[model samples]
Target: MNEIIRLQVALETDAEQIRNMMVEIERDETDRWYDNDERPFIPGYDSINMQKYHMWDKKYYKIMYDDILAGVLLISYTGREHARVDRFYIEPTFQNKGIGSKVITLIEGMYPMVRLWTLDTIQKSIRNHKFYEKNGYEKIGEDEDERYYCKTISEPIKEINRFNSDEDFSNQNFIQCNMQNVDIYDVNMRDSGFTNMNLESGIYQNSNLSNTRFTNVNMSNAVLGDSNMNKIEICHVSLADAYIHDTNLGFEEQKAPLIMERCELRSSRIVDSNLQDLSICNCNIEGMKIDGILVSDLINIYKSSLKTEINKM
Candidate 1:
């Protein structure tokens, strides 16, 4: 799962690009960041007027998360000892993945000479206050509607891309990125870290796929050979259908879809799924529950009744 969060110099098309994406943001969240006068994120904001307003100079950037334009920032007076963050906003879909604080930290490295940084947010944004405070900014003053903040930097901070645990990761588009022969290992990237990742024609060996959602995707012509698919859900999609090979249905060319030997199947669940003509053999079935009844118990009761009938015969 590649999560590339980068800040690039604002381009000519960035304003319109970000505006085009604004329609995708949640309605309530859109209201939160765009309803007021000092909304901080102006859709019509452009680099030309940004430079004109910031004494004819500014450091503007567009926040890119993977292949999507997630947000933008405008820093005025970057050449001086003091700088101001004129505007900073992340799309609602891009927020809460922990991007804001990291953006603030990156700004520190962008301007090495700026000993002090300043910005203000709407007073209603308590999360913004806490976010700034968490990043070492202190509240200096506040008026009726705006809350001012400033942070001091003793030295230049180096920029690093961590995605801050809130990465716009998984199922992300990698446009024009050449990723050939990349080796990934020894990471805590489980569950949420790699959800909905595009593993098309990818190999996975000796991996534990816990809490993975394999629903509503096409996986036609996948050669499982009875690999015992557990917890995989597909909706209104029939297996082996030609249309199932597409994204909406999705798995094709099963290069060893699954092979299990001496495996543990304890506490595994299969629910609301088709198990027509399923078979099991040479496996442990102790305390195996089906519809809340133990398989062992059912077998024992059957055996007892059979013995009694044989004696009568």
Candidate 2:
């Protein structure tokens, strides 16, 4: 399981390092952020820019991932109901690992009273445009060299289709959409398609999962309790350290590697699964059986030999 990402307030001691990172970001965009027509001269990228924006309403947060610094976020609350994301930059090495989206989601959850959230990005950066759009932001307009995007938080719920009726969904594409908080219990999803979709906190109990596929899907903090998983497949999915309690992994043949660590199995059989590199430590074993032989009987035989050795001594 991965640790949750967080943002801490940037301290005064972090000023110089933050400025250095900002400078690096500016240099990464050499031809961008230049002046076309100067209404008023502004230092677009400067070391003392934070000091200039040091106010009660403005905030700077240091992005922390797994207890390590990974990025920075600067925002301002201009009014009681409005907020703006002034700037955000993640380390280049940590760009596309879902940290940016998670950080933005956390920020939005932090400010539930905020109605209108706005931001401006360089128009030349096509990737930036796609990112904001994927996060449900609408492109309102553009000015000089900046593209303005806004997301109204209190907008009406748009109607969305949530159920499928015995339809084949295999080999289809569904990207950057919300399927969160939807009921999928006892649904026929065999050979279905789910890619890059937010199915967070969705239920999948008593469903047909044979030949069902999942890639890059967010199943964070989900429950897979008391479900039959006979011949089910999963690849590259985030399970959020799920608890698969009181179940048996019975497979006639192994296809992929299975890893079981820090778990408890009582009165269960591990058949035909890949146990290569399997480790069992710090476990209480009594009346155990392996390969149709009583393990406890074997240990007792070995202990009897120890007693014989003691009699010889």
Candidate 3:
């Protein structure tokens, strides 16, 4: 019988462990896919290449089962509109044990309206499609080769602005704080701990979130235009549907934490932040530090535009 396992998101500090897990999984899958009678033809090199890219771009979440690395799920974002599950694979030994389903459920519970892609040719893929369908995902489109398919998870809209005063809120604790639909215009939250707080659908225009902590905080559907987030320490913070424009995020002493996904910042100083799939547009970013980083299309366009302007001068 398969052992019951619990899942948790891996941290950036666990990079080496995650890499090793990826390697082992690749090797095992390669052996199975080639040796099995079905011969699915899944490329092991492709898995390795994708893992390397994810490590370089910092675009994956390590799925831990009972404190052990069981599998990996590659996450990608397209603008503020949606998040995509680019790749997901579990170990052969751990397959068909409801662990994958549990992980998907956890992700969907955390982030509603998430999207995922899968190939149609593989027989196992049909079961994958069924799994997603069982979990409230609906098919939206398919490609010609029957290889590419898209699905989305729809969820009910939750209330965004309901603060609870009964709960004790220490200066260093943001446990279960609801900042939804609340307008925090021009406030200073430096060095404060807002970890695990849900700030969905909130507006934080021209506010300072410098040196603040946001571990596992949910800021989905929030608008933070023209804000200051320099040196903020964030981790596992969901910034989906956030509108960030003209924000000042400069400084060396203050470094934002890792685990920032699906955030949109325009004309903002994003030095030394774990910026995977972050979309930026129409910004003056001369002398910016983006070395050895995988920037999104919007940021690339902004950089290209900046280069063009400089060349014209």
Candidate 4:
């Protein structure tokens, strides 16, 4: 009889089962990529480390088919807009039955607010690459040993974290949180409150910050690139020397005031914003518009020598 496949939070007791499965997975991977001279697996590869880190994320789950163990998954929260599918392997016995694809779909639903799902695998794992691509993920980057993949979510994020006072945040959780000078990449942070956090010198790359609050935060020297910042509210924030590129900052319904001073903007678009009383001086303005009126054309007409002749006529 076919058993129902489901995902449940894995308990510590399941470590042995997961480790045995990992051994098989490691053997398969090693066989696929390594020569006879190389070892089949890393030295000191312990099940304890796997179980420990999996529990650290608190999102590790056991993939069960009917009442039997099928596999394990370790998806961890990396940032506000991304989740990392650290490990996804089906038991060799359960392979080629469409269980992996179902697990992916389950994960997507589990975090509806996540804008991007990212993972990495051995560079030579062609089968893994194809599986991820078939499930809507695309290759983003790669290194000498691993290939990184990402899938973007188009759904609107409506999840909002409850508002809390700054006083309620403990110093251990806020001040000494050690959030500085760290790399936070590809994490889903929808509707989260970073309103009073001091994230100085942090690097937030390829992350989703939609509907996230960043009021009164000191993000000085932080790098925010290739991320989605849709509907984010940023007030009294110091973004000095911060590098922001290829990111979305405009919303369709809400009107937000964007103030730029002594900053360089190239190849970026601004729409549906309040630019009242805007002043421009000593800057190169080209190929621009406001309400379907080209500012460049208006400036040419007003500043041209022919303006006097037209006025007289």
Candidate 5:
């Protein structure tokens, strides 16, 4: 559809249409997602008096699509890179035409300085969860009746290419930033944090990463050499097509001869690896597979063959 979606600052004259539009939305959503008996719900657009009262200090916008009133949004912007969607809804007729998603993108574009956008949804509304999650809003937490969500906006520094080297950035907070292609070496990063970061194809040499926690990290096609990983704990991680090598002088040998000892592997999958002369003792072999065959099935077949040979004897 060739449509132009935009947001305009709502005026006092637009109160009646907004009230009627919200009524339409309330009627459509009644008994569908949330209970009608819910208390402390949004009553801003319920009537003209409430609408004007709530729109006093907030930036209320009338969502316009093709010069038509498609929806209404009440945003509470602090002008300091934080905003919240107090209330947002599309008219019943304008629902499910991809207008709601486009309007959200429009709001983000309108407030380029906003680094965090937060909103709340009815906790029981699974459909709404799918919609918001698909648009990059993560479900942060849930209360008695509502669920909170927020999306962090990352704006890359396009002008600067090289960060000054030999700098002490310890305890410095870097939030909502895109630091791709940044390089560093021989720095004190201890007692620092790297959350929601991307280190794909990154190089780390002669660095101290001891006592660091990496959760939900993807280190695919990467190398870990000449590091002290003794007594390190890993869980629920993917090591597909990966190699583990033991070396001397704390240096990884080119020829990987894995010698895993004192490891507790629970519910882990080892697929398509070389295990010649490997001994497995005191472990669970139930439902284990080898070469696309189950170990239990092979054992049963061997038992049946042995019984037949004894009867022939």
Candidate 6:
């Protein structure tokens, strides 16, 4: 007879139980799949360490069947507004059950936006793709190799104006607020501290964000078109998949920061942003800047083209 299972968000004390489940899952996954030289999937100590650290954040969930550890679901926050369903796995013995779908439903009810990624190359896991589609996620886009399918969760809350216009938000400590899809046009946001906030898919046109401080914020998939971001201090911010066209980022200085890693910066004009000190690894920067300067070994673009354009000035 199949036994009923219980699902709960893991607490810090459940670390030991979760760790053991992770080990079992890794062993089972590795044994079933053969490792390729190019993309080998090795179960290592580092992966366990990551699980331990990530579980402490209270974002992970552990599934138990008949009071025994079954599997784990890893949830990572893209900020406060968006959460990514990083890893969802059930033991081979527990496959074909409704555990995965139940967990996804729980996540969708709690978070505004949840996303998960799967590979199309995994023919064996084609049922997994169908499972997600059955659970209300849509295939938004895909990467090269026809693998890495991005699936988005249900729709976000739609309000004409979610941000308070009359409130004196300047010099306030804001944390983990959702400003997605809000029309924040032509506003002056200065000397504000926004940490771990989600500004995804939000429009910030003709807005002024001078001397604003942003740390650990997710600006991914955000539209910063035609915004003025002068002298802003942005550190450890994720600009992944952000659309930044015709924006003025001049005179901005980012220090020892994680700026624009794994992002696309198409048609964005960045000038005099002391980006020389920042790391521009894994970013696609296009278009021209009048005084664009580069100074880090991390950026290995066409130096002659950049220099020639600079020399002409």
Candidate 1 C-alpha lDDT tens digits along 84-157: 78778788778887778778778777767677788888777788888989989999999977899988786534
Candidate-wise lDDT, in order: 0.58, 0.66, 0.54, 0.68, 0.70, 0.54
Clashing pairs in 6: none
Q: Clash totals for all models, in order?
A: 8, 0, 2, 10, 0, 0
For every model shown, what is its TM-score relative to the native structure? 0.42, 0.44, 0.40, 0.50, 0.48, 0.44
lDDT at position 138, candidate 1: 93
lDDT of candidate 5 over 1-313, digit per residue (tens): 7988889888888888888888777767775655558533554447776566545554788889899999888886643456778778888788788987897898888877677788888877787888899999998999978899999888853343444656666667777897665544335655445566666655453346666666766666655543554434565566655545332323345433445544555446664345666777666777687777988899899999999999999
Best by lDDT: 5
Candidate 3 local accuracy as lDDT?
0.54
- Mark the regions of model 6 whose C-alpha exceeds 4 Å error after superposition: 1-3, 35-48, 79-81, 112-124, 144-146, 149-313
- The model with the greater lDDT, 3 or 4, is 4
Evaluation by TM-score, superior candidate among 1 and 3: 1
Higher-scoring candidate on lDDT, 1 or 4: 4
lDDT of 2 by residue, 21-63 (tens): 6676666555344455432221344555443343223377888
Lowest-sum lDDT 10-residue window in model 4: 163-172
User: Candidate 5 clashing pairs?
Assistant: none
- lDDT string for model 3 (1-313, tens) is 3655554454556656656665666677545544554434433333333344454335477776766677887655432224566557787667887887787777655555333333233333466667767755556556632343455434445553333434533454433555444432213467676555765555554467777665665667655533576545554444443333323335556644334444444444544335565654555445444564435555788999999999999
Residues 1-313, candidate 6, lDDT per residue (tens digit)?
3666666777767766666666676666555643552332322322444555556457677777777667777665543343456567787777776777766666666665333333233333456668767765556555542234445443555542234546655555544555454544224676666676765555453457767776766666554533466545554454554433322335347423434444345555553244455544444443333444543322345676788899999
